[model samples]
Target: MSYLSRSRSVYGPTTSTTCLNKDDEDDDDGGGKTDNNNNNNADDHPGASMKQRTRIGTWNVLTLAQQGKLIQLANEARRMKLEILGLSEVRWLNFGEHRIPSGQILQYSGLRGENAPRHRGVGFLLSAQAHSALMKTRVRNLTIIQTYAPKFSLSYDAADLQDKENFYSQLNATVDRIPKGDIMICMGDFNAKIGSDNSNYERFMGRHDLGEMSENGELFAEFCGNNDMVIGGSLFPHRRVYKVTWVSRNSFTEYKIDHICISRKWKRCLLDVRNKRSADIASDHHLIIGEIRLRVARIPRQEERVGRQFNTRRLDDTTVKRSFTVELQTCAADIPEGGSVEDQWTAIKNAFNVTSENNLEERRGAKGAIQRSKTRGAIYSARQRYSALEKKVKRSCRRDKRAWADSLADEGEKVAATGDIRLLYHISRRLSGAKINATMPVKDAIGQLLTDPTDQLKRWFEHFEQFFQVPARPPSPRYDPPRVSEPIRVVAGVRQGCILSPLLFLIVIVEILVGAIDREPNRGLL
Candidate 1:
């Protein structure tokens, strides 16, 4: 009846909502009437309260060449209390009305392609009971691509690395299509590994190309990192004994080939990874399972339970297995110390809720770095091409000069006429800066003509003739262009032209110092 009692009643019955720890406490109001009233309110609002843990599992069912094993696998999944199940390596016959005995309904779909006949695919199995509990929704932020890369066999020696690159590119584009703030789960078997290992039960840390130390594995690491996904369930406590999927009926060597990866935003949502490894099963590969916490609305119908409320998408069977395994490793690593299963789920909820601008900026920076590296590489290539072209041009110029001098002898008659002689001598001088003198004014005049138009050339020629009282010969012993590698120095006893102004001298000195420092560390030492 009093304010304190009313306030106490409003905040009553605390439930654990913090990370990794759950503790329950009941506080009574000062007035017994407040407690009675609050209890009455709680009774009427059953939908307003209730807590449930949602379990999700992922597996790569190397499609039992037999229908019976497939059904058994589905039933086992149900028996395991898996509310949501993702399966890879599902043949078409294993889908579309095939009965899963757990009485659970798998709302399934597959990728569109010409290989449909092979029926190799990925899908989701919703416990029919679980499906009946929640509301249904869909999100298509990323494109789920299922591909079986070429194995390094004698028949296919050429590497499928390029194909893998293109596939990842497409996958990233699909992930980008999803708008920010929307829940997007891009999961499946990416035939790549974080790294090679003999362990199926132990934690296998993924590596990146950054260094020899493993972060994630090669292209797989790059793909998952670029999309911000975690490789769940791979970091468990057991070494893989039978790791390979898709085994030939007679082959004995088993390889750990499948993997699962998820966005970093959903890191906390991951719970546990279960891998079934008994060799007695008809399927060659072990069944992988991923457990996830579902935050369900308390008041939903059976179909509206957490099942329908959580966003779901279908993946290829092969991809599902791969991603499941990857996620298994990642989830194991994500488990914080001293947290309940509930706490782990809560962490995932908080982690995957929404991507912040900080995340986008980080991705942008990474992409920008890649783009810049590519741009720099292209610039270097262009410079190399230009340098090659410059050398070729120099060689051709030298050859042309030799040919022109040889031709001068054939035009001997032109040397006898003034205008013809001037033209012939000009051409020769232009071809090679090897001759000149006042007596041979034609040669000197030709060299002057190179720097000026005909009018200025004529004036220079006239001035030369009048000053020396003879024909204006080209300056004997023509000037040769300096070689790039040669040190520029005025010869002893040779006239050095007028020097530049003091300001120009200062600028030149500063430029020289900067250039010297940039090109030669020894100069700085000096």
Candidate 2:
């Protein structure tokens, strides 16, 4: 099977569904490489090759009219075997109604608030397979939105300063919401350049610095620099194709306006950026596709820690003196009969072992440095684990409240029917701070509690949700009589007995009559 088909089969739609034609399927099963299959084998089977690399890409599909071209791009990306694809300038109507031409499943978001596209909206499309791989480690909190404020004012006057501030504020807010360590690709026609050649980008933008730094593009560049972000397809060092996204909607002026930026944490993962000539003409904006190798450094659990002795002593003069004495004997072996004064000095220097003593001290310093690094790593790891556990615990507590509430309701119905509503009410009041007793119906109280979960319970539930990673919604309590209590009354003159007990009584009577007969054997009329 071809690599693509194999990947699709292993992680794609079910094998039962055949989107490909019969001929296509034949070609797929025949030509599809087994590399992906081998990857699966490594996971499920033994002695399999490990996945050491992953490739990611990004693209801006021009317009909805070029849907066919978009699909072709997606196919090309798939052909390139991209695990993650970050797409920009994808317009989606209200309530997410647009369909991607590429069959590749997409996780997208609609434009923020109305004012969609703002002129042009930006969206992201990640390969379903890539998402799955990421989900294994951490869930992706991808944010896709469009931001555009006409930078080029009709008048020669510069754009409003507030506009730039507002843009940065919105951008920062959006970025803040994204979970840390998540692979995020923020890309679009930012309508700005990050760096410049002739004029220092920073100097050109005057001292009207607000939340951000630049006037045209330098502000964005500074913001990215401070945030430790990398500009993908940077035309620095050597300019390949510099182009602008907007040019009178008809006039063509090549400018590298549209771009993609990634976090510096993913620096190693960024593999290559291919600015295809075909892609540039495909859209008004040049298509800058980036290929990133998604790699996870498999940290081998520390070798079952061997207990090592910690020594505080440094290489001292005593050790150096001892080494010098040992070298003195060796120096004699090097000397011949009647050597020059220079030769004698060299022999004395060799006997002193000065270089070896210095080398020993440096080695000790290096060891100390290594120890400190390991200690810091351990501390950091511990802190992260603690934070994760704390979050989990909080979530668990929240879930427990609902569970505890349900239990109380079940037990409450029984007590309520037995005129024990007060007892259940006290329990609810104690646990969830909701009172349900003779004065209040259980259903009404439960509704109120769910509607307004107290801070304590809310916190508990949040933690509960975090840990269990499940919705913790309790069912509304209903007064079911069967689950409660009922009065009981016995009917009069009704003998309820089995034959064994009744027969035993009769046997006792016969035995008594026989005993009486024994006392008077001839008494036939008893």
Candidate 3:
């Protein structure tokens, strides 16, 4: 089937992969390739022929909770041959990994409470190919966080300042947790405008960035600098349309807020980063894609069955909470007190598990059906009205079109506020397309690329073996010091969150460094 026909069939009449009108085409910067072959070529460099190429993309899907949206996204990824897709505002509840019927694995993180609105969620959808190479996933509070920073006209408030500080703190903690040797790609809707100025920030930024820098942009740039990450979008040459991820409802303004960044050490792995304006999803945001060549090993299978997650949401009910407490007490009482520490621990664990099974709810199926139905119906109605307005704008005169567009924009906000998640998502998507991609290839000790998954794994093993290899110890000193008669006691390590922990750590590190320096044989030469 033709691409257009397939898109129409899957997405319905309102959405099309092609531009709405000839004028829309004119706005396009021609940075994106429409043909599949062109895309494949664009993703692979001539020198990277022997390397395995993986396409990673990021898009603000508005909300994954929308009916059929998750499946639609998976299909789109398949069509585009994207190996990994990072999604923002997924709106999925809780934190977990799920395998879709298509064999794709989706790892999502969202708010914890059952009563919490499905908002500001983030997730990664990995194709079978990418899923096989997955090593680990770390979810942090602010890693996929979103907040409304003060705009140019708005003065900064205490709440806004606190929010920004909290975001930065969480972001730093997340970055610190990443293994330095592993390739890191950090991308999202930063909501910061990093202009074309490469001044002082030349190490982490490029001249290709669009618009002038904002206050948030400074924070973004500083974060990249500290983490040694390079902005992917700023390094590539693309048209204005391809560079800009957002457009105003009036169509008179555009901004490049969505960005993808990678560790500067793995910058060469990124082949390209550009906006795919032709993708026809309900969301207004264009998809941002990045190409990289990397080798990855499949995870070994295990025979262990995963445990069922306890629905902690049930604890909100007073009756359920009371029942759970009574059941837990009863179960614990049955465990005998006369046992070894290990046996007692195991018995206590079993008691909790049994109580949970009996008292806690099981989260095995779709949740919030009533709310979902209401939201879905509202979104559908809003979409129909928006479609009508779009058609009218297309056929109307310039002045009338502007008025209609403004009305359409206002209507979108109203639907969003009404908890029509899909409509709200499309509005956010149209205004800010946030996406990110990063990848790194595996190589052997001799710098030879390892294409096979098994070879990649073996190469990593060999590389680490050599890296951690300790040299032979020198012969023991002829004169050994006499052992002390007094008993030596070692203090326990400092608690992580203690006020003096950082200071103590710093002091210990300094002492170690000083001792090492004092003992250095080459100290006299210095």
Candidate 4:
């Protein structure tokens, strides 16, 4: 084949793998997320045990071209506690890793070039922990290759056939290149229903699958059989609700199109594969998470810093203030008066949280996670209500953020008139968004800049290790000192963050001075 033929995709050069449109493309009315009964699903635990398991999932978002969708999707991923999420129909141009503000890494492959039309794309959004695992995969070598395949069709269209062939052929080549020893996980929106019948293809899939085998299923089964990848989802038996990944926008009909498969050698490593309906990105498809039993290195958090506080300026509004006050009063009423300091603090924090959640972000429930029940009538009404609520919330948030900036600007102007340089500079920096990265990266032994967070942490650990090393001295008396008694447990009179802590400290110092003067009058103690 000529380079030109291989370079361009079936849907032209704009999109390489997935077709631009499919009947299963959208859920315009959206779908219900956050089902209460889904708590009993496998992989519900947060994998906080010695046997560190990683949660990897695949999703068909249809299109991520819209605003705020990616952030909402990321939040959903965090709530689902997924380590890695493969995405389809991302519709983002170019191929690269984009580290979002949330510290998650989004590594995507889309149409190449600046002018490439944003169409079908495949990508992986990795949590900080998951990215750390991928970086340290030498200890646990694992490779994941995801794809976005065209849907099955009735007509024998040449273009459609070409698209399907392109996906399978590319996938086959990619699978062939992987080492036999490495665990290979192949997942994505195949759009192929393998059905519940395990006839002839028992080795590749399980009989627990949903729906009837379609034309595309035959090809997918053949592909997995050739590759020796056992379908992870089918291997585990679960209710049909857990298995269903795609539902019609109307919330009536359902199908299982997305899949997660593991190479035969590591089939036992796949503990569970299920759909998380709660992770709604307003798409027809649900997030399919697979629990792979691998000891992943826990990614250490970055240096502790105060997180962004809420824009409290909104409380200045009378209606908002009144609502917040009422909610706070109700929440406070629920708290007991007598408790330990820690318990009381926690209660107060909860009270604040409840009030803020109620009044501050009023539009928060409008997003994809708008308390869905999955019924037809519920989903329809929810979608319509969400559509209207979403706009209102977005506009309200934008206005509030803008007002905060304006208030900062106004404060800066007043401070300028008062000649408070520090206040003016602080306000200016806050309003300008702090474009410059101020954190200085660490250096390796060779003095190369360690830009990756993991590498930087490693370098810092090495530095600290060498810095605290015991220095060799001339052989002095080798007598070991006698063990000292346990130190006294000291507690301060005033608690930290108390307004009168400094005042109480001064009072204590005054008492010491008074006692010293009374005991030994001016014995050069001054």
Q: Pick the candidate with the highest TM-score.
A: 4
Residue 43's lDDT within candidate 2 is 54
lDDT score, candidate 1, position 70: 50
Task: Write one digit per residue (lDDT tens) for candidate 3, span 233-342.
Answer: 99998878689776553334678877888878778868789987645345656678887644233334443444545757668889989999998888888989898999
lDDT of each: 0.42, 0.43, 0.60, 0.68
* Candidate 4 residue runs with Cα over 4 Å from true position: 1-50, 130-138, 298-321, 338-376, 393-526
Pick out the ten consecutive residues of candidate 2 with the lowest summed lDDT.
9-18
Q: What does candidate 1's lDDT look like per residue over 326-376, in tens digits? A: 655565566586779899887665443322222322222332232233455
Q: Tell me the deviation in Å of residue 342 in model 2.
A: 76
Give candidate 3's whole-model lDDT.
0.60
How many clashes (backbone N, Cα, C below 3 Å) per candidate?
Answer: 81, 20, 4, 0
lDDT of 4 by residue, 289-390 (tens): 887654344435554644224547669899999989988988899899898999999999988977786666544454334344557676777767767776
Best by lDDT: 4
lDDT of 1 at 206: 34
In candidate 2, stretches whose alpha carbon ends up further than 4 angstroms from where it belongs are 1-55, 65-73, 79-82, 95-102, 111-119, 131-134, 138-160, 179-185, 198-214, 235-239, 242-252, 280-282, 296-526
TM-score of each: 0.38, 0.39, 0.47, 0.62
Error of 2 at 224 (Å): 1.2
